[model samples]
Target: MKFNIKNRVTLLVSVWMMSFTMNMLEGVCSIPSSLEVFEHHKNVTGKKWAVLVAGSNGYENYRHQADVCHAYQILKRGGLEDDNIIVFMYDDIAHHPKNPRPGIIINEPNGSNVYDGVPKDYTGEATNAQNFYAVISGNRSALSGGSGKVVDSGPNDTIFIYYSDHGSTGLVSMPEGDDIMANDFMDVLMEKHATNSYKKMVIYLEACESGSMFEGILPNNINIYATTASKASEDSWAFYCPDYGLPPPPEYTTCLGDLYSISWLEDSDKNDMTKETLQQQYQIVRRRTLIGYKDFHSHVMKYGDDKLKNDLLANYIGANPSLDENAYSFEPSTTQTRLVNQRDAHLLHLRLELQMAPEGSKEKLKARQELVDEISHREHVDNTFHLIWDLLRDKNNNSTMMLNVRPPGKPLVDDWDCFRTLIKTYENHCGRLSSYGKKYTRVFANMCNAGIYVEQLKATTSQVSIPLTSSSTQTLDLSSIGSSFPTSATLQELELVTSIDEELLQEYGDELHRFGKVQRVFVVSLKDRSSHMLAMTTSFLKGDYQDELRFFRVHKSDVYESQVAVTKGIGKYDVANGYAEIKVVDKVGFSTKGGKVTNSKFLLFHIYLS
Candidate 1:
């Protein structure tokens, strides 16, 4: 088909050019495009599973349950099915008597009700550490009293877990039972990884010291990513509290949401999941939580697989195509200006209850008593720790050892067993270590780090005798022994011979002789032993000017040989107010015949004031 003169040469060139073009087209078709390779690796068949937990109960802890419910709503809207999501909450907030809106719970001021449609798989007593562990491990047999829903996923599935609660140095609190310890939690995650239960996992934890759950413990190679509301040494703040500028309705008293929780949640609510990466959301949340608040703030921390931060949020949560493009907006100024410390939120709730109760009514009295008890309980916890520290320091001669904090990048304790055993030893002697007491767990960790022995702690704990007031003291029937006694007595006139025991003299000789010669004062009564001897004693010693004006009262009881209940100034003796223990050091030269004393005995009184 070419022209004549150079026809043969032209035809040969045309044929070669056509062959080259055909070979190029064939090569292009043989190799796959970048978009096709990306689609292949996306593995579109993978399913998403989620677990939402609220690890606290009571109206004062309304924010936890509310946070969980809001998270459920987000997952539901993200196209995750109800069957794939498991919810564990105490489920007491929505219908609680203190709830202003009887059937509704909101995460923020003027926010939509998140309480609706939240599954009650684990509620009431079922919301505990055991059940939570079982759920994560997919061990249905280990769970008790719940709907038995667990995160039963395969290797190709993506898992998301969100927990909101009160946390301490190395554990997160549970509603009905033991707390979720950090070591145990990490063990569960490792077991899950070993079993190939999921391809990737993402965790969002909201609690005081939430970062302790994973910091320095979670391995980056485990294919798991976690973001915490606060670092191991800080407190997470609560938002929309009663006194805050962005408070909820006037009828509401408790906080509406936690600061870090609401930041990520509201960000998710407004942003397009497909267009956002987890790292982007974490940055947004961290900024919002740290800024716009002058009084309180917490560091939003991330741990584990840093590479996972690059993945799209839609891979785990999913996206809503119905939302407009402009929905991807965030405003730090819109965030609440006032925030409350998570631990003190309950105090605010109690104070509100006391303030709102009707004046002079039984409700008001009950509220007032409850407030008083709460304050007293906190004082008791503080005092107990202080006493424990004092005793430990006396032995070790280290004043600041118990309160020392480990530097960053180091674990809470080198030996987890020692830390746990010390806590058990303290609890065994002192009583239940309540949520308020959990803050002292770092002290236990420090002791473990310092190589403190459990036996030493036990011995120190035994020596710490908590002061017992009338309400905490046990009742004793002293009616039979009080009939044979004088109505009034003075320490100077009532000269009774007594000898100090050699052991007590050796231990407390200086303290005992500091007041002068040991003098005996006794008073007995059948009725009202604590108050009857109020007017009996006028002075402690006759000659010693330092002890002359000091007043004292002896509370006689059949339970012991002799006990003194002394007051400092001249006032009515109220046993309910205070008392001192008088230990019997020795009993010498006493002879009893036919239930009557035949000979005088030298009785020693060891005075120990608390």
Candidate 2:
């Protein structure tokens, strides 16, 4: 099944005409001077290089990849060679099973096939933060896959970077993996500056809360200029939406372009690239992306060197060597100008699928379930965070939690360490905080605004527990007993205490019966993002003070404070495969596995230590 649509011929023709018009507008005398200036720049600035990245995958996110391909097309037409332009996209949408057009991708409602010649320098899982940095820093040794083509640029080169993806405050999601944190990304830029990788750089990003990447952290003197689709607190929008009158192909059910993305690209397509200054282009994109739609929009923002706005678009995007006066031009009708929130596009498509599906059919049922799950997942995440908030408020009787912080959204402070600790604590106790957990980030911001410490929040949430016996109990003070019992005490001491109170020992293995006070618990998840392995401090036994348990893949420098003991008979049961057992032996370094055993590993366990 494929959508039968012609690649817009005018797209190429307009490029030629626009370039011609720009040259014409510049006048004959201006052309020689402009060439002289560019030639001088070429001598000083080695080459122009671009890194185009679309940080998402799947059929539903067609627009992101399409936007990147379109950007590549513009840069290519502008004169940058393929080797100078590095592209990072999942490269899955064009031929996706669900794609209406098997080998084609369009940016606008009735646009050209932008995907035809886009480079696949890096694709799939390789399009991650690690690879992105490896490419930017020209460290081929750090690259994981693809052709391993890096920028290979020097201080004399000019760099342009464009990234389109799903983003939240301080983080951007990478497909099927962890996110790219703003601080880490800034570190990469600082590294580039420190190494003199380029003379000047330009960055354009399209994502929900894209501005957060540069709003406060990006330094202005770093020779980098940036623009984002929206402010840190808002969602970027999609254009040519479901209600755009022209129905999408039968196999597709969503918008064709991102609002801010298409606004700038289309402006480039229509106007003269040579004549268009970056400032003029920004004004055009800002106006159309925001006010023209009158439906859904976001505040497009710019950061870094404001003077760079006067530079020619050709300096970054490139310009054609010659133009054609007889080229074709295009202007979309009002019917094609609808918009929707980019973050909600997939969910909206699923709902539309269910709405349009035949009643009680398999397709209808499948769509219904997907829609329900999507909504339910979001609600579940919100409910979980709200539960944590309520529990903490109730436990501490802190009326400050009742503060009205909702009407006007609050900005997240640059306190990355605070937010990271708080998020880790929640995940350590609750579960893996996935994409849905991102919506709760603002709650952490609110907590920070309320002057709450991360430890205090951790303590409040740690109070939640499941009843283990007929009598409910609060946190236990085992440090007092630890004072009398030395780490070198006989094995009989361990047996004597457990034997004396077997019930209490069995009730809480991870927390309650502590011989010496537990200092910290470190949780490690597999690199494949699967099951979690836990390590906890058992006693202050000097060299061999801690105990290690279970299995999860560890990274190169993943250091846990505890000792390492590879549990034997580990493969006998796999948790993800539905069979697992966990036990805490009276003696250290003892391992037992086989049958499914229920313990703290499978339950929500808490730990509080002095």
Candidate 3:
């Protein structure tokens, strides 16, 4: 204890040497040698398994399948075996009639074909939520179709999952069957963790509002890491669209890939994975996704097990041993320059189809009709939701909250069952919730948060009704109107009929002649429907007159039916406006058999023109 400083230093060195010798002999030490570290790394034994899914089908949704196929190519190049990779795609893009290059799919403009050698483990109707869950849970017996290949991994395995498709708040759509709910998906992951199915897992989800899947719900303690294309309330964009500078071939009208998807895939393609960490890749991807577009971009979000960010990408996706770190580099300029919102991409496809079809041909006619129907359906969905909100407000006297966005780290709803039941109740009363309509799910969540009862929703929805369009089997019943000719009918009188049938002018024929040679009859249906002077150009039309008159339709009111300005006319008729007094003049009948409209009835009205 009284030794000098020099003697103490000598004694400490001798003690350290003795401890080091004992550690070396026992094969354990606080700091290992380089050779020992290399041996430890080499002894790390685990299989890398991946599940790639494209949750949508059709030529318009080509980007999803293309993304999945390109991911497969990357995984394969990274050294993962085919057996360890399970793919679930609708598999309708390659040989589709709209495909410019049959049996070939490309992820970028003039890019190499990614469709080749892609496995069809699940295709067509087999690409569904049930099969997706079964595959992830490794419950092969639960699978109904496809190859029945599941992610049968052990505790030492590393799992990677990539999904690209249309998503809404708290749900991701599948090509067939029900959508995969966030709660249900998390339940499966929790089960996997509870059973010690894997050492670690990573998920890359690309879709609109994909962040909703993991936000506030995924426990960070689980050995799972997730990255989403967008936050819980926004849309992920589609890149390489026909309008972009680096678009697909001239023959292709749809986008080739999604912005978030191509950012990561291209990064993987041009990087040495063994030298890159998950955090680095995520930063690069997030930056590229935001910088690639000028107007539209998504917030790439990461969730769960933050510590896993330090893990090498090679742990989940095998590394390319042949790749030299210096040979590959990530270039920000390589990202897409233009992006289209995923929801609006379908309109681009439809518009392109209409433009390409020969004018006056049946193809052009069909294309035009389809374009009209799509526009109408969108408007109808908007009106339906608005009506639902109005009804809810009337019942609860609450402030408007349908469009409210939850704060970050907050789940869509506190009660998943309430959210799901409300959606079902809405669909049961209204028609099926189309992909576009899925955006209104936030409204449902808001309602659930407000403690809006399902019975109240059912009652409110039952009172709501959507008008039948040209796509519906019901046709207008004009035969009920007596042949009595009113000298002239004001546009005000016709507005009621317009509300009942927006396509009246297009469907009307000789029946109009019975009313007499009409002067300028400015018949305006839904305000945004069209601007063409359809009535003047009809075969039965005769004379032209002055004084353009415009009128608005009246929506049903449980409280009171007050005359409201439904819409304004375009051009000259804009200034000239009037109000129509709605009075049910006659009643028609409707008969239905086997859910098909056998015969239908409609309200008839009569009014005199100035």
Candidate 4:
């Protein structure tokens, strides 16, 4: 970047300004000046890269040498520094051994052209699989190793684990059975970076049947994404069929080496895209690869059975918090499992059935709600199923996950009195959404802790527990353990949907007092275009605690003209998920358009407990 002094000064100002704003809005109202650590970014550490590759040179390899060449193009693209890169490949005839395909060659105006292939053992036959592995592990002689070096880690790094290989249903093997343990490789990858503090890790796999690799992957601190080839067996043949490359080059089956690789990674037509952009583009191709493979397979089979296909699909995908294909792969013993969730709704079939039973016909409404509440609150617990999937997802695929929720399953149900009486009790104890975000940290912490409680419920019920000797001992109550979990921090913003009712605010206000001191409540009325924003203090909401609360008001003009209410003070922090429940009141306060009011849309409320 050849920047003039003017440009450098502008960047400094921009970075400083944005940092200041973020700190202030997040309630960091004070910052010390003249810290020695503020300057000297030169002291910050650099980064590193990790790469993996496997190649073949039989009939397909003979025809797709362009693929080998493409790998070089990817290495040279963007700002990927040379010292940081590691390349694993089987790009020459010796590694190709039997039959060698001519590899592709790329020339960067300012970069090294790296696809020069070596001679010997030349033929049209595919390379022996052993050479491929040997080449990657650095077992070859001088001038006979990888396209790049072997790198494991760095202070703050960016790792790229890429592959282009041939595969079958569950394995990538050479005709001679030289396949590495796919699961083992994934485990090693994640284990290598167990602490997961890298800036990001990118896994770009180009192989047949590669899509299935998503199973059993666990990431450390990296984001794991792969081409649909991860599931189905796929070849990177440059032109075996008419419908393969991006936009299906009219007559291709195997994806050739140089096409997607060179164009996207190396010579991307979009100059504006950076290394970061290239990483994201990999996702687009990964999904498209899956749909493409499925389509190709379907075209070959000619089977239009939706149910059969869905069952076949269920053979692979799952959400047990582990490998989907593994858990859902097996049919549950009972018909209950099959019929219970056919509609794809979040409702738990057993609980819903009990709920709809006569309010008196079943074991009583209390018993039914207890059962419903248990399942609805599944998010708070970690069950065997969660454990199962976590163990099975391909370690590479789950590296740095961003979704903030328990693995999706039972707790996926909606929260309401229908599920938990505590919800109702808490509301009645406080008021309504009023105590939301104010004491939010405390409130949600208990809710999160409640999840800990449910796990105890399951633990006590586990069949493997040894019976304790009893003389004159009291029976243990598992619920007591449930109450021992942690409390989370308060969220800065808690805007409820416009539909929530305003009248319930007071009750929520009271319930939230459990977390910490209640400060203030900011409610914008949904009823009228001119509805004034209400600032309720602790004294106004809680008659007894009024004396303990401190209140401050800023001029109307001083408040930012934004709907997001910023929480202040030391306890403010982010939550695992949006800990506060969001509801759309049956009324509308504002229309879909931001303008005009009269009908109720919803209200915003947040809660934070200590």
Candidate 5:
């Protein structure tokens, strides 16, 4: 059946950022006071285990129920059985929109059909490698004494865990009624008397201001990964809470909690993607995750606490060094103010690398507990914190003042040919970084029109390598979504609002508005690695879709802010070097006008159609 065209009002895309107050005690100490030994690669292998801990009580305030389910399913699919996992549930409906189960599904349901059956926890089987799974299905009062397999599980397991809820400073609040300080979790694992039990543990924590617990405490026997850098409540609104509300209520839309997990899993996958490729995907995933959350924040800010950390980032470095090797070079004095003797500099760097491990929190465990203090005292470590043995000890070497130098690998890649490739790759992996490690900036408007497209969004091909630092702009084509949605005037209006020229402005604006007339439209703003939904208007509007409208999205590698910010600053739209992305929707139909001339109910007079 043919339908009439109607345009509705709607916000096109939603953009938000998370501000965090992270506890960075380890980041400060791990600055590498000397130099690193990257030339000589190292590897530590052992049985791997993953665990997911979820507290889904308040769905309205800290809604992360989907994340809980996603974590469980992924773990099970990855070969983790009932024996190696655990889930904790609270009686109250605080974390989840409504009370929910730990894993949304069971490994093997009682019924023959997979989707037809119910979901269950992983506590049925007992595995060979001491692998186990436990779940605390409701309330925090039970958590204190509820040390299921988590306490008994060895430190060596590759535990990928998550805590989704409200957090202040170092404390992660439990529905049990009180907050569990971040330091408490670290104390459980970092203190040699306790943490030494595990061999290699990796903790992926999700909460607010989680970075605070990291102060002074270095991860040991485990790898520590966090969502943000500092304690920031205002950031969450920008991070996940919608500015207005989600899917406009009665329409609970999806959130961004699983984005990071997806990227992490994909990046680590040995299948079609390499570690390098996966890392690149992380930035995209991270940005997309933020976008989803931003839409959420925009949808639900006024209804609840607006103070929120709207973003997530890797606050801890817990990866173990894969190799150790070095190549020597002495070129001087430009970037650094003071120039030192080439020979002394080389020696200084060598001294520093001797004591420290390059990556991973597993090896750092020994260092954090003073188990290596005996070795540290007798050795003369270089600026990089490398500990030297008795024979090489130099009392005069400065440990506090020295800087950590990275051992030589490949040629210096400051120039674009090499540097751009690497940074761009990082962006592809983490989505937060440009292929190189630069922050992305948004210019002009929310979308960019590269050219007049039809069927596919193809742009004028230019630079092959990303991470390029140059001021350039390209046109995008339209016609894929429709051909007759918005009229010329509507297109002009859209272009003017979005900031396009008069000539092409009207054409683009009308086109966008035409798409905006659909029953419901999903608008995507690709800015700074984040793919956010700008609009979810049930009744689309004529002015919403712009055929050739232009806007830009912020996407980059701030991995810090470069990882999530839409652009550096507001206003200033310098065309130097920037990129933008957008997605639009709409509906249209013919219109006719007629009059009942005879008034007999059955008699119809002249009909006018335009």
Candidate 6:
């Protein structure tokens, strides 16, 4: 084992090199003084810019605008000048008829008006998704109309963006317009990065399912940090809800702030911005937002650059107390507070309105009906999807309904195109899924998670129909139906109260389609015992009679010849003996030249798919 002097020196050198490599691999722990030379440690050298957007309108959504206005106050106090800040709010709240203080808007209980000095760079319809993207990407031409303000920043600028609104799984609503879908927003961020818009950006989102905006799309290297009020599949909570008996001021009947939003704003208000870091504020806010509401707790989430956590709050918010003369103090209470689900906030408000109104009065009855309708609408959506789920279960032997697969605490469908398509289809047929339709996005998400194709889900929906309950059924006397309404005396209409055979239903199903897609058919039946009839109506496309299902029954007097009359009307060979030939019009709903067309009264003998 004895080695020569040269070998021994080689061994010692090798050992020394190995030790050096190990030290390099496991980064050497350095003292704070030694780390001062690191570029990140040096004070962030940049001018600050901000974009605060409140992407919702209406008085019940008071919290969104209030959140944005409050954030504006914080950034302004932090010394970011008005010239450097861009604000986009619906701007309807300050002067809203519902506002007790017409010109002032408040965030916290008895809080000072954040709306007083706020800028209205993009207001009204101008505060839409198009302007939002335009502002983010600095694309003046992309915006249809607005203040034409955008983020005019360089690599040295730090940008802070705060958006408060109503959000579905992958969409944030813009007032009077389409939503800010995740894909589009992600594209804007990428464009901003490519154009060297900012050195770093901090985004705060206060909306239901806000985390979906960044969940799988945001890249960690994008120099962006996002903190959302709720996770990918949960509702963000609304706080200071007077409807639930917790109001900052007595007259404030709606929610004043989002739980996650107000938590951070209040924390910013109380803490020394110079001393506190963004990480500390996030932790405080996250804790406060999740405190005590375990039954329906919204999990706050953070995405992108973990390193940005150590950045000073003052770097983005501002440290100049002198500039905060208009800012008011906020004391967050841990007790006697309630949180409202964003989807149900308005319903709760209506419920409270009903309770406060004089008993049995018109206003009270109206409020009660509104509350009931709201509740019923939500239930109807759930019930409709449940019906689809039941049909799918029956058709597939209960195999594809996602009953066995457990989803994450929050369920989300990561496929954007598929989700968009499914949602659009639902909207075209069912109605806008926002507000009442928001929560049902999860049904599609579940379908996606279960490895079910959107096409299959849509097709399933097409085949399903809502049957009227026995209690809702009315036995119509066909003889007297539609007699009260005017119709053409030359044409006789016969009402048939009968059920179609499965074979006939299958034949009709083959002809049914959606959006002109020959193969797609969605059947939705009336909740009342109403009948749909297949009419030999004159086609607007061909100017000839075609077989089409008319949900409304035609009366004898209501069936009239068109203003542009045809000598050879719909022949008996083209339709049934008792069937009336009718002309098509440009408007929706079945209308006749007669006095008025009444609703169908016959029990439509339509075939039902098993």
Considering every candidate listed, which one attains the maximal TM-score? 3
Query: How many angstroms is residue 5 displaced in model 6 relative to the true structure, after the best TM-score fit?
Result: 46
Pairs with steric clashes in candidate 1: none
Candidate 2's C-alpha runs over 4 A off are 1-44, 245-251, 321-338, 356-360, 393-411, 428-436, 448-610
After TM-score superposition, the amount by which residue 467's alpha carbon in candidate 1 deviates from its true location, in angstroms, is: 11
Ranking 3 against 5 by lDDT, winner: 3
Give the alpha carbon lDDT tens digit for every residue of 1-610 in model 6: 2244355357446655655666678896423221222222224467778999888888888889999999998878777789879999988888998788899999977788889788879988788888888888878888877677788888888889998888877788888577888888998999899888789999999888788788877888989999999888678888878745346676765788888888788778777676677788888877767764545468889998877887777777777354333334444455555668888788666756666667658976586556645554555566566656775666556554533323443325656677677777766655567575676665666566656676776665554322222332222243443422224321223432122121111112212222110111112123353322323222222333333322224322222221111112233323222223222111111122354332221121321111
Candidate order by TM-score, decreasing, is 3, 1, 6, 2, 4, 5
Write down the RMSD of all candidates, one decimal each. Answer: 14.1, 17.1, 11.4, 30.3, 30.7, 16.1
Please say which candidate is ahead in TM-score: 3 or 6: 3
TM-score for each predicted model, relative to the true structure: 0.73, 0.66, 0.74, 0.33, 0.32, 0.67
Compose the digit string of candidate 5's lDDT tens values, residues 301-367.
1101111111111101122222112211112213312211211222222222223423446544443
Greater lDDT among 3 and 4 belongs to 3
- Where in model 4 is the C-alpha error above 4 Å? 1-45, 50-52, 62-65, 93-148, 174-177, 195-199, 219-255, 258-271, 275-283, 286-610
Ranked by TM-score, the better of candidates 3 and 5 is 3
- Model 3: weakest 10-residue lDDT segment is 532-541
- For candidate 6, the lDDT comes to 0.64
Error of 3 at 131 (Å): 0.8
Q: Model 6 — TM-score against the truth?
A: 0.67
Better-scoring candidate (TM-score), 2 or 5: 2
Backbone clashes for every candidate come to 0, 0, 0, 99, 191, 8
Model 4 scores worst on lDDT over the 10 consecutive residues at: 310-319
The C-alpha lDDT values of all candidates are 0.72, 0.63, 0.73, 0.31, 0.27, 0.64
